[model samples]
Target: MPDSGLEGLLRELSPQVLGALVRRYGHFDLAEDATQEALLAAAAQWPGEGLPDNPRAWLITVASRRLTDLLRAEQARRRREDTVVQWTLPEEHLAPAADRLAADSDDTLILLFLCCHPSLSPASQIALTLRAVGGLTTAEIARAFLVPESTMTRRISRAKTGIKTSGVPFGMPPEADRAARLDAVLHVLYLIFNEGYASTSGPDLVRSELSAEAIRLARIVHRLLPDDSEVTGLLALMLLTDARRPARTAPDGTPVPMSEQDRSRWNSEYIAEGVALLSEALPHGPTGQFQIQAAIAALHDEAPRAEETDWPQIEALYELLLRLSDNPVVSLNHAVAVGMARGAREGLAALEKLDDRISGDHRFHAARAHLLEMAGEGAEAVESYVEAARRATGLPHQRYLHGRAARLRES
Candidate 1:
C-alpha cells in the first residue's frame, strides 16, 4: 500500500514537476532527465524515511537540486563562465519559498498544451503526453500503440528532442492559434480515454486511473473554454461510455458484449449526468463527430434493455458520424446496429460494402460472422470467426471468437 501510494504521488505530481523543470531548463529533454533523477531519489529515500507529508514539494525540491547539480557539472565540463550567470537566474527564480510548487490551474493547462505542440506528429504528441503528463510507462504505451517497447522508447526520446529543437513556446498558444491546436488536444484526450476504457494489453479490463485523469483534463478544458461544443461533447461522450463500464466486463474478467450485459448494473447517475450534459451541449448548435457519438451512447444508456435500444436513432447518429468523420470503424459499427434494427440481410449488404475498407480489422470479421450466422450461413460464419480469432490481439476476445467458432462446429 505504501508503494502504491508512492506510485500515485509520482503520477499526480509528474506533470507539474516536469513543467516547472521545463520552464527553468528551457528544454523538454533536460526536464524529463531531471524528473527521472528525482523519481530515482524518491524510490531510494522514501521508504526508509517514511513518506513525506508533502510528497510533491519534496519531489520538486529534490528535482531542483538535481537540476542544479547537472548544470554545475555541465558548466565544469564546458569550462564556460556564463554557466554561473545562467545558473543564477534559474536557481533564484525556480524555487518556491515554502518548498511547495504553486500550480495554478492555467499553468497545468499550459503544460497540457505544451505537450501537444504542433511541431511534433500526432503519434509523438500522444506518446509524449502519456509519458510526461499521464505518467504511463513506456511498456504500457508500447502496448497501446501495438509497437515494440524499444520503438516506443525511441519515439518518446525523439519527441522530446523535437520539442527542444523546434523552439515551441512553453505557454499556451494565442487565441489565433488556439483553434488549430484544438484538434491535437482532442486527439490526445481521445487516446487517453480509449487507453483507460479498453486498455490495449493488460491483465485488467479497465484502467480507471487513466480514465479519471482524462476526465479531469477534459473538465479543465471545458472550464477553460466554456463555449467549445466539441469539448462539451467529448466530456458527455466519455461520461456516457464510462457509465457502462460497470457492465462492460464480467466479475471474472471476461469480456461482455453490450447486448448480453445486465442493464441493471449500469450507473443511472452517470447516465443521467451525461444526458444532461449532451442536452446542454446540443443548444450550442456546433455539432461535431464527438457530439454524434455521444448521442449514440446516450441512446443506448437510455434504453431499458438491448431490445429496447433505438437502432434507428443509432443508425441516424452513425450516418451523421460518418459524414463528420469517414472512419471505417464507424461504418462497421453502424452496420451492426443496422442489422439489429432492420433485418440481417440489410445489415449484411451494408457490411459487404465495407469489406474492402475494414479488411484489416478483426472486429469487421467478428461482426460479419455474427451476421452470417444469423443468415443461416453457419460454415461461412465459422470461417469468419476463425479469421477474427487469428487477427485478434487480446486474449479474452480471441478466446470468445474461437468459442463462437467451436459452437458452430458442434451445431
Candidate 2:
C-alpha cells in the first residue's frame, strides 16, 4: 500500500481515462466530471481492496457508466428516450496499472491543446490547464492565483464553453493554428514551472515537487515536438536555471540568493546538458524568448566566479529580450543586468522606466532596494526593502527582505 505509487498511477490514469471519455462521448465537461469521480472511487477502494487486474479498464468502465447514467437521466427528464444510450458497468478491477499507456494515443496532447485553445483568454487557458491538464483541484488553482473559488469555477466553465462554441476538436490542431496554440501551451507550462520554481504564496521558497513535475511535463512536450527550437529552448532554460536548485536553499530550507550560492553545489551535468541544448537551438537562429533567456543563463553558468560573470553580455542579451517581449518582468531583470554591467545609477534609471507597470511588484521593490543600496542611498534602500518585505507573498522571501531591511537600518 505505497501511497506515492498509487497517487502517481492515478495521476497518469486520469488524463487517459478523461481523454478516452471525451473522445468517445464528445462531452468534455461531462467526461471530466465522470473521470474525476472514477478517480475518487479508486482512491477510496484501491488501497483497502487492493489494486485491480486492469486498472485503466476499470476506470474507463466506471467513468463511462457514470457518464452514461448522467446522460440517461438527462434524456429521461427531457423525454428524449430516442437519444439515450445504455452502457453496462464492469464488475472487475487491476494488478498494478500498466507500465505507461500507448505513446501514440495523443490523448494527453489533445487534452492540452483543448485546454489552451485560442478561443479562451490567457487567464482562462491557465485555469483550464491547471484544472484539466495539471490535475490541480479548483481550490488549489484558486489559492495559487489568489482568486475566489467561485470565480475560478466560472472561468473554467467559460473556457470549456468557449472551446465547445469555437468547435475546437479533440484531436491535434491544424498546422496553421498550431503555432499560436503551442505558444499558449508553452506559456501554461512555464507558468506551472515558475510557480514550482518560486511559489507566489507559500512558506517554502522552492516547491521542489512542483518544479520537478514541471520539468517532467516539459520533457513530454520536448519529446512530442523535438524539432521545434522554442521547445528545446524552453527545456534548456528550465534545466539551466533549475541546475542551481541544490544551492537555492540552505540546509534549513531558508532562501539563498544566487550571488551567495555555492558554485560547487550547482549541477555541472545539468549545466552542460542545458548548454548543449541552447547551443543547438541558437544555431537555428534566435527562435524566441526562451532561447535568449537560456543564452543569458548559459553565460552565468560558464562564469567561474561571481566577479567573472560577463555582465556586459548579459546586459546586452537582456536588451535584446526587451525588444522581443515587452513583458515588465523582462524589464525588471534587464535593469538588474544593466546595474551589474554599468552601475547602480544606470540600472536605477532603467528600473525607473518600468515603475508604471512594475512598481507594485515585490521583485520591483526588492530590485530597486538593492540598486539603491549599491548607489549609497541607504535610507531609500531600507524603505524599499521594507515595502518589498510587506508585499512579498512567499514567507521565505519575506523573511529575507525583512532581514535585509533591518541590517540596512542598523548600518
Candidate 3:
C-alpha cells in the first residue's frame, strides 16, 4: 500500500487497537502509550512489508505486547521506589491471540465515551478525543489549537488521569447516565466542528483537517445511533455548513461573506445529502438546535441566488432556536436574520435590545456594522466595522472587517 493509504488505515485502527488492549488489561494510559508505539511501528514497517492480511488484528497484537512491556517497566520502577504498582502484568498471554471475536469487536465508540468522561473538563475532553480516538499526535493537536505541544501533552495526561481516578469502566455509561454521556460526546464534537469552521484566533479562517475529522467522527456516531435524531441532525448540520467551505475564502485568503460567495463553487452532493438527512431526522424529533441550524443552512443552500434566500423562514428558525437556548451569539444571529427579513432599521431596533446581552462582543459590532450599512448610515457603519476589527482576534476576521470599513469610506 502507498504511504497515505497505510497511514489512513493505521489511524482508523488506532482506537480499536487501544480499546482492545485497555478492555482486556485495564490500563488506559499505558494502553494509549502502547497504541502509539504500535502505530509508529506500523508506519515504519507497513510500506516495506507490503501490508498485513489482518491489519486490525496485527495492531491489537502489537499494542498488547507493548502494553505488557510498559506494565512490567512500571512495576519495576515502583518496586525500586518501594511503592506498589496499580497495574498488573498479563502473564498468560504476551499478546492476546488474534481471534476473530477480539478483532471484530469495535471499541472506538466506547473509547470516545471514555475520553469524554464526566470527571474531565471540556478542554481536556476535546484534547483527549482528538488524541486517542481521532488518532492525532499530541504535537499535531497542539498545533491545530495553536498551543505548545507541552501544554497539550499535560492536558491529555490530566484527562487520562481524571478518567483513571473516576474508575469508569471500559464500556458505555449505565443506562441512566447514557443520555448525559451522549450529550457530552455530541457537544464535544460540535465544539470541534465549530473550531475548525471558524478558528478562535488564527491566520487561516478554516482549519480543514479539524473540520473534516469532526465530520468523520460525527458520521461514526450517526452510524452507531441511527435512530437518534440529534445525531442525524448534527451530521446534517456539519455537511450543509461545510459544503460552502470551498467559497468561504478568496484567492488572497480573505474571508468571504456568505451572501457574496459564488454559489457555483458549493458542493451540490453535500447539500443534497444534508437536505435528505434533515428531512429524515426532523420527523423523529420534537426538534433540536442542530436540526434548526441545519434547516437554516438548507434555506441558504436551496436558494440559487443570494437575494432569493428565505430570510423570513431563517428568522423564524432563529426564533425557535432562541426558545431552545438563550445563547447571546444566537441572539446576534437572530438580529441579523431580522435585519435581512425586515428592514435595516427594524434589525437595528432588534439589535438594540441585545445591548445588555452581547454588546461588547466583536460579532455584535460586526452585525451592527452590516445593518448600519444596509440602513444607509455609512459613517456609523464605518466606526462599527473598525471597532469590530479592533476587537477581533483572528487575522481573517480583522482583515474582512477592515476591508468593509475601507470600502464604505471609499464609497
Best by lDDT: 3
Ranking by TM-score: 3, 1, 2
Tens digits of per-residue lDDT, candidate 3, 86-178, equal 556866555554223444335788888998888899999999999989998899999999999999999999998998889887876788998
Q: What ranking of all candidate models by lDDT puts the best one first?
A: 3, 2, 1
Estimate the TM-score of every prediction. Answer: 0.82, 0.81, 0.95
- Global fold similarity of model 2 (TM-score): 0.81
Overall local distance difference test of candidate 3: 0.89
Write one digit per residue (lDDT tens) for candidate 1, span 287-327.
Answer: 98888889999999998988889999898889888888879
Lowest-sum lDDT 10-residue window in model 3: 97-106
Model 1: clashing residue pairs? Answer: none
Root-mean-square deviation of every model = 4.3, 5.2, 2.2
Local distance difference test scores for all models? 0.80, 0.83, 0.89
The superposed Cα distance between candidate 1 and the true structure at residue 108, in angstroms, equals 2.1
Best by TM-score: 3
Give the better candidate number (1 or 3) by TM-score: 3
Q: Which candidate model has the greater TM-score, 2 or 3? A: 3
The segments of candidate 1 whose C-alpha lies over 4 angstroms from its true place after superposition are 1-13, 33-65, 80-105, 137-152, 199-209, 250-253
